[model samples]
Structures are given as structure tokens and as C-alpha cells.
Target: MTARKIIHIDMDAFYASVEQRDNPQLWGKPVIVAWRGNRSVVCAASYEARKFGVRSAMPAVRAGHLCPNAIFLPPDFPRYRAVSRQVREIFQHDTDLIEPLSLDEAYLDVTENKTGLPTATQVARTIREQIRS
Candidate 1:
């Protein structure tokens, strides 16, 4: 039996990454994307924000305390959905065996890919570059 090669792609911090990608002002700065309320949960935190112990599912208030300089932005589901579709399309170009877990994460089976890539790592790198572009 032929072994199937699988590649997992997960954006470091999806919503936050999207925000940072779109807004040059947020680059290299801690970003927390979520609603702001007395009782609000964090949807995503950028890598810079994570450095301050911020994380998803944590309360917005706590996240602020963790990273006082963290830029708080509301989640933009529409933009995120658009980016998700783009990533899905890129994966489909390489293989039909694709499973999406969320906007930022997916699994691609590249054992027999359309791209004819020699290794799963190379496929993953290509996908990452595509997503970034």
C-alpha cells in the first residue's frame, strides 16, 4: 500500500495575522483581535501578543492586562472567510484531498498531488508562500 503524505497548515494567529497583513501600522506590534466588552473573549492573538502570554479564548480584559500595549481589533469574519477561500483554492491546486478545520488551519493529502511535488514539506512551503502572497 502506498503511504499517504499529509501536510498540516496553521496560521500562527489567524484573525490577528489578517489584521496585521492588511494594516501596516500593526506590523511588529502585539495585536489581539476580538470584541471589546465587559465580558468578551479573545478570538486570536498575534505572535507578538502571544509573547505577553495572551491567547485565544482568554478574556479581553485579561489579554489587555497581559499585553497592555496590545492593539485590540474586532474580529472581521468576512475578511477571514475571503482569506480562507483563497487558501482552500491554493490547496485544491495541489490536491483534491483537503480538509479544513478553520480559517487558519487545514490538512492536505499530497501523496499524489497535481503539482507533482517530490515531498510534502515542499508542498507545504509552496502553500505557505501562496497564502502569504
Candidate 2:
């Protein structure tokens, strides 16, 4: 069997990242993507929010209590999907052997890639540059 080069990309705090990307005011602040309700749960929490002990799957009310200044926003799947597609496009530019696990993560087999990159690390760097650009 041929060896495989698997790269796992973490679309870290995806929902919160998208929200921050779309709204400049959310930058450098605790951002939580979840509804504000007694029973609502956190869909995603930004790194800043995480510092305050907020995490995904946590109750919205508890998140608030943990970080009272945290900015809460409802989940936007459409925009997330669009951004996720853009990310996938970047990955596809390097390899086609991609297995999507979720909007926030994926496994990419880059043992033999279209870009002819020397290593999976290089491919990941290129993908990150493309995403940033």
C-alpha cells in the first residue's frame, strides 16, 4: 500500500472567526456565536472568549456569566458555508484527496498533490497564505 500524508486543518473557532471577519468591531474582543437565552448553547467561542472559560457546547447563560462583556451573535450558517467553501477551494488547489469532517475541520491526504509541493507542511503554508490573501 502507498503511504499517505494526512494533514488535519483546524478551522479554529470557525463561526466566531467568520463573525469577526465580517465585523471589525468584534476583533480583539470576546466573541461568542450563540443565542442569548437561558437554554441556548454556545455554537462557537473565539479565542478571546475562551480565555474567560467560554467554550463550545456550553450554555449561553453560563457563557455570559463567565464573560459578561462577551459579544454574542447568532450562528450564520450561510456565511459559514461560503467561507468554508473558500477554504476547501484552497485545499483543493493542493490535493483532491480531502475528507471533510465538519465545517471546522478536515483531513487532507497530500501524499501526492497537484501543486508538486515538497511537503504537506509547505502545502498547508500555501493554503494558509491563500486564505489570508
Candidate 3:
């Protein structure tokens, strides 16, 4: 059987990363993007905030306690959706076999990619580098 090459990419703390990317002030800060309410849950926590044990699905108040210095911001779904589209477009450029798990994650089947890369790992690395750039 022929090998079916697959590549998975997941953006770290997607919402928080978008926030930080768009706002210089948020860069390097522990950020938690979620709703604001007594019963609210975290949506995304930046790596900086994760250092203090903050995580998604955790209660907002608990996350605050875990990272006292963490900055809480409400999620902007529209903005996230827009960015997700952009990422999808990037994937579409290489292959049509893209499956998105979420706005920040996806699987790409690149066994026969347009770029003619030698290996799936190379394709994955290129895609990641493109996203990072």
C-alpha cells in the first residue's frame, strides 16, 4: 500500500496569539481570551499564562488565581474567523485535501503536493514557517 502523508498544524493559544499579534502591548504578556462572567470559561490561554497553570475550559476566576498577572480579554469570534479563513487559504494553495479541526488546527494531506517537496515533514515545516511569517 502507498503511504498516505498527513500533516497536522495547531496554532498555540490561537485567540490569544491573534490578540498579541495585533497588539504590541499584548506581546510577552500572559493573556487569557475568554468571556467575562461568574460562570464564564476560558477559551484560550497564552503560553505565558499557561506557565502559571491557566488553561482553556477552566473557570475564569480560577484562571485568574492561577495567573494573577494574566490579562483577560473577551473573545472576538469574527476576527478569529477572518484569520481562520486566511490560514485556510494558505493551506488551499498547496492542496485541496485540507481538513480543519478548528480555527487554529488542521490536517493537510500532502503526499502529492503542488510544491513538489520531497517529504511530508518538509511540507509541514514549510506550512508552519509560512504561518509564522
Candidate 4:
């Protein structure tokens, strides 16, 4: 039997991060990705907003009260999907054994990687740099 080396990538607050990246003004400010309504749920919240206890699946109304000054924007799914595809492309540069969990998360089996990175951590680190670049 052979051991497997796998790396899990979860981009926390992905939607909120994208929002901040796309709009420079939102950077460093609390960001909550949700519509403004009692019934709407939070899709994502930035670390800034998380400081106020906001979280994914949380009620938008509650998140609003938690961080009143937080930038609230409905999710931009199309843009997120595009970025997801790009991220997948970066993974392919290292390995083909990718198991996508969502637009912001995935698992990559790099036991026999294309990059010959020698270690799973190195492969993962390079992948992270590629995604950020």
C-alpha cells in the first residue's frame, strides 16, 4: 500500500475577500456579503466583520447589527466563478488530482505531483503563491 499526500485549501471569507480586492476602498474595512434583509443569510464575512461575530449562514439582519458599518454587498457569483476557474488552473500546474469542494475550497492529492515539488507542503505553498499572483 502507498501513502497519500493531500492538501486541503479553504479560502476563508472568500466572497468578502473578493469584494475587497475588487474594490480597493473596501480593503481593511469590515465586509459582509449578504443582501440587506431579515430573511437573507450571510454568504461570507471578512475577518474584519468576523470580529463582530458575523459568519457564513448567519442572518443578514443579525450581521448588520453586529457590524453596522460593514460593507454589505450581494454576492457576485459570476466573478467568483471566474476566479474559481483560475484557481483550478493554478492547481493543475502542480497536480491533476483535484477534488473541488466549492468555489473557495478544494483538496489536491499531490503524492505524485506534476511539479516534482518533493513535498506536499512545498506544492501547496507554491499553489498558494500562484493563486495570489
What digit string (tens of lDDT, one per residue) describes model 3 on residues 82-128? 99999898888778999899999999999889899989988888888
Model 4, 124: alpha-carbon shift in Å?
Answer: 0.9
- Mark the regions of model 1 whose C-alpha exceeds 4 Å error after superposition: none
Candidate 3: where are CA atoms >4 Å away?
A: none
C-alpha lDDT values of all predictions: 0.92, 0.92, 0.92, 0.93
Candidate 2 lDDT, 25-125, residue by residue in tens: 99999999998899999999999999999999999999999999999999999999999999998888898999999987999999998999878899888
Off by over 4 Å in 2: none
* Least accurate 10 contiguous residues by lDDT in model 1: 124-133
| Alpha-carbon RMSD of each model | 1.0, 1.1, 0.9, 0.8
Better of 1 and 4 by TM-score: 4
lDDT of model number 2? 0.92
How many residue-pair clashes does candidate 2 contain?
A: 0
Badly placed stretches (over 4 Å) of model 4 are none
1-133 per-residue lDDT for model 1 (tens digits): 9888999888878899889999999999999998998799999999999999999999999999999998899989999999889879999999999989988888899999999999999999898888778
